[model samples]
Target: MVAAALNGGGGQAGEALLTLALPKGRLAEEAAAALRAGGLDVPGEEGEQELVRLLPGSAFGRDLRLLWVRPADVPAYVREGAADAGVTGKDALAEEPQGVLERLDLGFGRCRMVVAVRRAEAERWPARLAGEAGGLSVATKYPRLARRYFLERHGLRPRVLELRGSVEVAATVGMAAAIVDLVQTGATLRANGLVAVEEVLPVSARWIVNPVSLRWKRPLLGELERRLAALAAGEVAAR
Candidate 1:
C-alpha cells in the first residue's frame, strides 16, 4: 500500500508532497535500494544522477519528493522542516541530537567509531594520556562525541581538534596524540601505522523525521515507516 500525499501543498489540489532527504554518495545508492525494497520506485544508481525527483501520485495517492544532499546536512534539513523526513548516519545524530525523532536503524553503512593511536604508542598511550595534566589531544570529525567519550567514560580531559576529513592522518602527522574516526575495514588505520585502541560506538544509517511533520503527516509517515521497518526486519532475518 502506498502512502497518501501530505497536506499543506500548493501543488494540485493543495496537497504537499512528502519530502525525503537522502544522503549523497554511497549511502544514497543503498537508501534507494532500501526504498525500492520497501515499495517505492526510487533510482538504483548513484552520483551525477537526478538529485531530485517527485514520484507522481499513484493509485494509493503516494506522492514523494526526494532530495540528495551531503550526509552531514541530512539532520539539519529534516530538523528545520525543510524536508518532512530524512536518512542519516547514527554518528551524525549522536554528534547533534535535537529537533528530530530517530525512527529506524536502516542497518546499512555499518562502521565503528573508535579511538586510535600509532601502533608503537598503543600500549603506552592510555596510561600516558591519563596522567597528562595538560589533557589528551584528540583529532576527530566528531569532536562532541569524542570529548564526551573521553571525559565521561574514561575520566580523561580531551582537547578535541575538529577536522573535516582525513582524521586518520592527524596522529601520524603529530597533530594529535590520538584520533577518533570511523573504520569500516581497518585497512586505512593499518596503512597509516595506527591501531584502534577503544571502540566508542558502532554506527549505521538511521531514519529521522521532523517532530512537527510527524504530527501533521502522521498517516503518510506511518505508512512509510511500516514498510521500511518490515524491510529491515526481513534483512535481519536473512542475515
Candidate 2:
C-alpha cells in the first residue's frame, strides 16, 4: 500500500515542476510567509478561496506550484505523488504515516494532543477508568490515536467516537465522557468546562516529502530544506 501510494507520480513534464501541498488556513499563511522570508517569492495570500495557485519560475528560478488542501490531507497528497512535498502538523502525521518522509520540523502551529474531561467529572475520571467494567467513552477527531492511547498505552478500553469538529461540546452535550483533542492554549478547554488530564503528544507543523519525490527531485527539494532551515533559525532568534 505504501509503495503503491508513493509510486503514482506525475508524468515526465509534470515532474519538472516542484509542486507543494499546503494546508488551507493559518498554517498555509505561516508557510507562505516563511518561504517568502527565505527569498522564495511565494505568491497568493492564504484564504484566497482557490484550489491551486501557479507561481512563476522567475521568482524562485524554478517552476513552483501550490496546491491548497485540508491540513490532514497534506501528507496524503505528498505520499500519492500529487505533490512533491507538503506542510502539516505532527498530530495529522501521527494519524497517517504511510509513504511519507518527515524531512523537517517547521516549528510553527505548535500545540498538544491531550486527554481532557469536564471539570465536574475530573475527580471521577481515574477511578472510573480504573474500574474498567464498562468501557470509557472518548470523543476525538483522531480516533486512531485516541484508541491507541486508551487501549495500548493506558491499558484501558474505550469507545472512541470520531467527530469532525466541536469535540469539546461532546462532554457538555452527553456525547462522550472525555475528549482527546489538540490544545494550543487552555482557553478553549476551560471555556468548555473541560480540564486536560494528560498530554498524549506535543504537536508542531512539519515539512514532509514523498520518498519517491525525494529521490527524483533532490535538487529543488534539498534547496527548499536549506532555505527553510535558515528561516526557522531566524524565526527562533527573533523570538
Local error of candidate 2 at 83, Å? Answer: 0.4
Question: Model 1, 7-114: lDDT tens per residue?
Answer: 333322223567888998768888888877777767666422666656766213667777688888999888888788888898899999988899998888889999
The lDDT values for all models are: 0.81, 0.81
In the range 7-103, model 2's lDDT, one tens digit per residue, is 4355321655777888887687887777777667676464347566666572358766677899999988898888888899998998888889998
Which residue pairs show collisions in model 2? none
How many clashing residue pairs are found in candidate 2? 0
lDDT of 1 at 137: 92
State TM-scores per candidate: 0.89, 0.89
Question: Which stretches in model 1 have alpha-carbon errors above 4 Å?
Answer: 1-15, 46-48, 58-60
Q: After superposition, how far is residue 191 of candidate 2 from its true place, in Å?
A: 1.2
Model 2 scores worst on lDDT over the 10 consecutive residues at 4-13
What candidate 2 gets wrong by more than 4 Å, as runs, is 1-13, 44-47, 236-239
- Displacement of the residue 180 alpha carbon in candidate 2, Å: 0.7
